[model samples]
Target: MGNAIHDNDSQMLYLKKRLNMFLEVLESVDPESTNLDDIDRMIEMVDDLEVKVHQFKKSE
Candidate 1:
């Protein structure tokens, strides 16, 4: 129904917003910290977020 469509749209927007936020954090990474294991983890997390977002869209 119309309500389900509206809910999905809202959730999609929220997910996109979170993606942008993650991208921003990635962009702000300090070059000096790039050598650390945590940096690798952060990059992986962003990749995972992107994959999950794509999967969510496909599911919808």
Candidate 2:
């Protein structure tokens, strides 16, 4: 039980870090020069995050 809790905590930390990275990238983006590829990359990041979230939940 303790190990499971620790694993969950680690997963949460990883998720938090990933989210922060996404936010940092978003904040650094310049709207005036933003292109389709940038938008696609951001969408991909969100999708990856969503997948990790689901995986974390399933593990619990």
Model 1 Cα lDDT, one tens digit per residue, 3-58:
33235677677668777877787788888857678687787878777776666677
Tens-digit lDDT string for candidate 2 (1-60): 133423787999888988999999999999999999999999999999999898889888
Model 2 earns a TM-score of 0.89
Clashes (candidate 1): 0
Candidate number of the best lDDT: 2
Winning model by TM-score: 2
- What do the candidate models score in CA lDDT, each in turn? 0.71, 0.89
Residue pairs with clashing backbones, model 2: none
Residue 20 displacement in candidate 2 (angstroms): 0.3
Once fitted onto the true fold, the runs of candidate 1 whose alpha carbons sit more than 4 angstroms away are 1-6
